[model samples]
Structures are given as C-alpha cells and as structure tokens.
Target: MKKLIACVLTLVLAVSAVGAMAEGLTFSWWGGDARHEATQAAVAAFTEATGVTVENTYSAWSGWEDKMSQYFASDSAFDVNQVNWNWLFSFVDGEGKSKMYDLNQVADIIDLTQFADAALAQCTVNGELLAIPVSMTGRIFYWNETTWQKAGLETPKTLAELMAAGQIFAEKLGDEYYPLALGTYDKMILMVHYLECKYGTDWVTDNKLNYTVEQIAEGVQFIQDLEDAHVIPSAETLIGDGADSLDKNPKWMDGVYAGIWEWDSSASKFGAALSDGQNFVVGEYFTDIGEFQGGFTKVSLALCIANSAADKQTAAQLIEFLLNSDEGARLMNSQRGIPLSAKANALCQTEGLLDPMVAEANGKVIAWCKNGLDPQFEAAALKNSDGVYADAFDGLSYGDYDVEEAAEVLVEGINEVLGA
Candidate 1:
C-alpha cells in the first residue's frame, strides 16, 4: 500500500466545514445498479446532514464516456463528476490548463489529509490538484468455475491451455459457449498487455507509442489467433448478442460466456450477475503470455469539481463528505473498490465492510501488474464507445481489414490522438 503524504493544513477556516449550503449542485457518474443505489443513498444522507441539494445524473458506463466528453465541450458539465484518470489528458488544453478546479482553493474545506500524495499526484496536471482518486484498479481474469467444471477442465493457468480449452468447450458444450468474452476496449487492453509482456516495455512513453507497425501487427495477430481458436467471440458475434456490457449479457449471466478480462473493481458486479450456484473465481495471470510478465494498474475512478461549477466550496464539501466521513464511508463500502483515502480504508477495515471477492482480486492485480499506465492510453478519443479501439477491432473482426491493415489503422489513429 502506498503511504499518503497528506497535505498539511495551512489555514484555519472561519466557516464551518460541514455547515449548510444554499447552492444546489449537479453531480454525475456511471456505474451498475449496485453502485447507483449505494451512491444515491450516500447522497441522500449528505443532503440531510448539510442542507445542500445535489441533482444527480448517472447512467450505465457504455456510452457515458462520450456523453461526458460532450458535456465538457459544451461547458455544461456537472458541478461534481465521477472522473476516470485519463480525463486529465482528455479535458486539458494545449497549455496544460485543466478543465477541473484546483482543489487547493477549497483546501480548508476538504481534509486533504485523507488522500495520498501519490494518488493525488496522478490526478494533478500543470501543478493543479484536479481530482481526488477513489480507488486503484487493473484488469484481471475472472472465470465461472461452474462452467469450466461442466467443460471438464480447470480454470486456465497458461495462455496455451486457454486457447486449447476453447476447442474442448465447443466440442462438449456446443457452438454458443466460449471460454472468454472481450469487447473493443478490452481487446485493445489485452493486445497492449501481450505486447508489453513480449517486449518488456510500456505501451506509450513520453507521448509516443512504443511499438512499431510490425510489432503491433504481431499483437493484432494474437487477437486474430484467439478468434480463430474460438477462445473468444468475434466482434460481430458480440454485437449480435445485443448486450451493452458483458455483465448484462444473458449468455454471461447464464455461463455460456464463462470468463472475462475486467477491472478488479468490477469483480463484484460481474459475480453478482451470474446464475445461482455458478461459481465466479479469480484466475491466475497466464505466465506464458510472453517472455516477461506485464500489465498496468491505475486510478479506477475519481471525484472532480468542474472549473465551471457555480459553487466550488459546496462541490468540494460533497467530495470531502463522500470520501472522508464515517457515515459516507460505511454506505459506500467496497462498491468503488478499496478506498484510496486512509480514513475511509481504515473505517472499512474496522467495520468489516470490504467485499471479499473485490479485495482478493484487487490484491492480485496490484501485486502482478509490473508497469505504470500512460493516461493517454485510455483517453476518450481512444477508448470511447465509437472511438479508435472500436474502429480498429470492429473493422478487423468484420473482415474490412486484415491483421496488418488493422495494425496500420490502429497505429495511425493512436498517433493522431497523441499528436493532438
């Protein structure tokens, strides 16, 4: 665990930090039903405690990224936002000016002592404290143990075994069954992970892509190899399934889609979606993916005050209350993963509020991933619903581009974002 070098208090504010506020603020986020419920409850409690009226706008994560992008561009963003780490680069300007407010302005109101300097550092841009991180996360494998048992195989511990199991599943369980499912952004993440393991390098370094066309072509081939092996469904099949996300897919819930490559923070939601008696177990990272071990962990989500907020202090108070207060901490539990705030984390520990599956997956992810993620790797232009990742993988899967051609398109599009 990273130690928090808590920001020291410089001023004793005269105003009551938790006092009633007259301004009505807007807050927005994206999550599953569980998170929405937990957060709304917390918001209600916050409102009761402090006379602040907060209007909430939240939705599923699917197209929420693009909608948030539009909100920022239109200068109509909510006063408080549940921001992803990459938004630091996505919403910032050419001169490094941030779209988020400098939290330092409300330092007297929010107890900055709850946040680690390291976590706070990732949310900073051009010396401005832009956002407060909620949790750290990395993608890890999760499998439906019951489905694997029915296939007469154990959860795969090696990449070769995983590909081989696809054949076994098909022969035994028929055409609709798959060992794993991945969407466009998931494929993008997996390809980079494969390359990083082979080359022993980060995906992006100093605003430039680290791999050449040929090297990336090899990664693209690996994705094609998975489809050929039936280890995962094609993009066309995933589209045909008509589910917005894997967790919401009937096939996944019923165990025909047996595994996922997903963020550790999401383990609970996915596990909860499975049919009764289906065992959802965390899987070991495949050691034979390449010559070296590789993956990256980053801030899972964060709270930010928009620069356009009508009342900055009130917005900061909502953040402070949600992350640092005992009432808010208990209500949130591990809905957002292990809290990055020391006070919240300690409270969860003492109250026994941690979700066992989420904690276990989180522990494995942080311990295994050996690289730092470049924020731009997940910038909206690259990871959004209809963005570069979707285009590259969709075109490849739909037969519009061969592996090499897809590599060219992927590289060109990434370069455009990096140069912008």
Candidate 2:
C-alpha cells in the first residue's frame, strides 16, 4: 500500500510540473491577414517546442499607435509588443530610462549579435537597449502599370512626367482615376520628399525646423498643385469612400488609385490587392527635382518586452526564437519586411521566400537615402493625435487655408510638439 501511494505522489508531481511549464504570455502587433497567419503559426511552433502558451492581440494599422500608447501609459501592454521606431523617444523618461524592459539585461536569452550593428544601435535610446529592430524601411513610389497603360501614359520617371500624366489620366480615364493617390499623412511625407529634393536639405536638424516658413509654404503648395492638377483624389473623396485605410479602399484595389509612395516592406500587400492582370512596379525616385536623395531610411518596427511582464526571461526567449532561429524565421519570412537578423535573412534567401520587388526596392532606398531622420518626425502629437500634418495639408486641400496659412499652422503646431 505504501509503494502504491509513492507512485501516486510521483504522478501528481509530474502533472504539477507540466502545469508549471505552461506559463502564458501575450504578444501584440498590427498587420494584415498574411502577417497574422505567419505570426500565429510561429507562436504555435514556439508553444509546441517550449510548452509555453502565448496569446495574440493584433489588428490593422489604423488606431494601433493610439491603442499601444494607452497600453504603455496604463502599464497594461502585452508581454511582447511590436513597436514603431519613434516610440522609443516617447516611452523613455526624462532621465533616459525606458518604460520597456532593458533588453540588454536579458542578453543571455536574446541574441543581439544576429542583427547588424547599425540596426541594433537604432533600438538603443538613452543608454538602454530598448528593443530589437525587425527590419529597415523607406518610402518610394510604386505604380500600377496596367492603370498607367489604360490612361495612355508610360511610367513617370520625372516630376514633370508625373504631373503631365495626371492630366492625361483625367482626360482618358475620367476624374475617378488619378496618376497617384495620397492621403493626409501620405501628403506630409511626399511634401517632405519634394522639399528635400528642391532645397537639397534635410527636413529637420538639431530638433529644429530646417526650412523657413515660406519654404514650407512652397512644399505645401506643391501638394496643392498635385490636387489642383487632379493627380490624386481629394481628401473629401477618400473620406467619403468610408474605408479605414488606403489598402482597404475599393478604389485602390480596382486600380482607380493607381500609384502610392509607401514602404518597400509594404509592397506585397499593395500588389496582392490589385485586380487580376494588374502589374505593380517600383518607380524610380524623381531625380529631376533633387540633386540629393530626399528620403530617409530607419528601423521599420521593433519587438519589445513590456516593463510589466511577469516573466521577462521567458519573454526574451520567445523573442529570440521568433527573430533569430531558422524555424521561426521560416514561418515569419518577409511579412514584417526583410528580417533584420542576418541569419533570418539568409534563411529566407535560401528558401526563396523574400519578395523580389520588395527586396529590390529596399536595396534602392537604402542606397539612395542620404539624410538623417529625426525621431520626433513621427511623434504622436505631431502626426496623429494633434493631426498637425494632416490638419494643415487637409485644410489646404479643402480650401480652408492657403499655402502660407497652412505653413504657419504647421510650423506652430510642430514647435508646440517639440516644446512639449
């Protein structure tokens, strides 16, 4: 009878051990269906190997920043979070302490050496390694060849050609079609590109505005010129379409909005969204306007551990597997852009998983970009919350403000954000 009791006790301990290994963690991110599927599969594989459970919280990009901001502020974010590059500036305290985990502290579990030195450096803020950068990205133009052909125009290689194509498209395909499509934020980036090209200067330097108010007016006016020339749909028209984002807009999928200036990592989704037989091709930078490259490249997104995580060591292990290991890399592939991990990139290349167009575009942007980007350029107060860029540009688009007025408002709003 005593022998029987010993065996039963041993069985109970085994069950308890299994329960202990089943620690649960939460991971959050923003992406489309393909990313969601790949990430879920990765998580599943991780769980199968490690006996740990991970809960996923993900959605489209719209409103994700605000949601994560709230989560971080409330100390209620997931154990693992997919963070934007600029978030490092906002999430660190005055003394340069991060609100997220110091990834360096868990170096044993996480493989920092798998990433490039420059990529890793971008994640370091205020002496603390805050997160691991997943990929690099920059904005460049992409054209739907079928749409351009339908409008009886070749792919635009210069600013003049692009403007001319706008009129041709309007005449040939009616007012519904345009040579390019730009929303409020899109206009902001494109305006920066135009200003950089025209003036041969960076957008900001030393946390101060580099361009004069009048010069900014010229930039804003250029966007107005595009609208007046019918190069893109009006802001009012996009809003009326009632889509949550450009990618979701039926007009874009149908080829009505034919061109976009977007990140190289995002090329696949845009291409996938096109109708049957529509050809998507990366376009060259408009070199005629600028002697120097106007755009900048930076870490696309990062994987970070929340300060509030109950088990940081386990979290670090999970991140390591997802970003550094062959199996996890295979599952993730290029869904999060090109992987920053040298090993992961090599793995993808060996497997033929990297999207060719995205890979080429990424290389072009990296080679061409000559300017440094400011972290504050993407500050929530400036870009999204206060809608500084959107308000100024959308006002100009809707005729609520002229170029000068819009520029003044933009400068004042940006200064306010900087001061805060």
lDDT scores of the candidates, listed in order: 0.89, 0.88
Off by over 4 Å in 1: 1-22, 93-96
List model 2 lDDT by residue over 205-322, tens digit each. 7778888999999998899989988898888998899987778889899999989989887777888888898999998898887677787888999999999999999999889999
Among the numbered candidates, top TM-score falls to 2
TM-score of 2: 0.93
Per-model TM-score versus the true fold: 0.91, 0.93
Poorly placed runs, candidate 2 (over 4 Å): 1-21, 93-96
Per-residue CA lDDT of candidate 1, range 14-112, in tens? 233433344588999988888999999999999999988889999888778778888886778999999988887678656667888999889898888
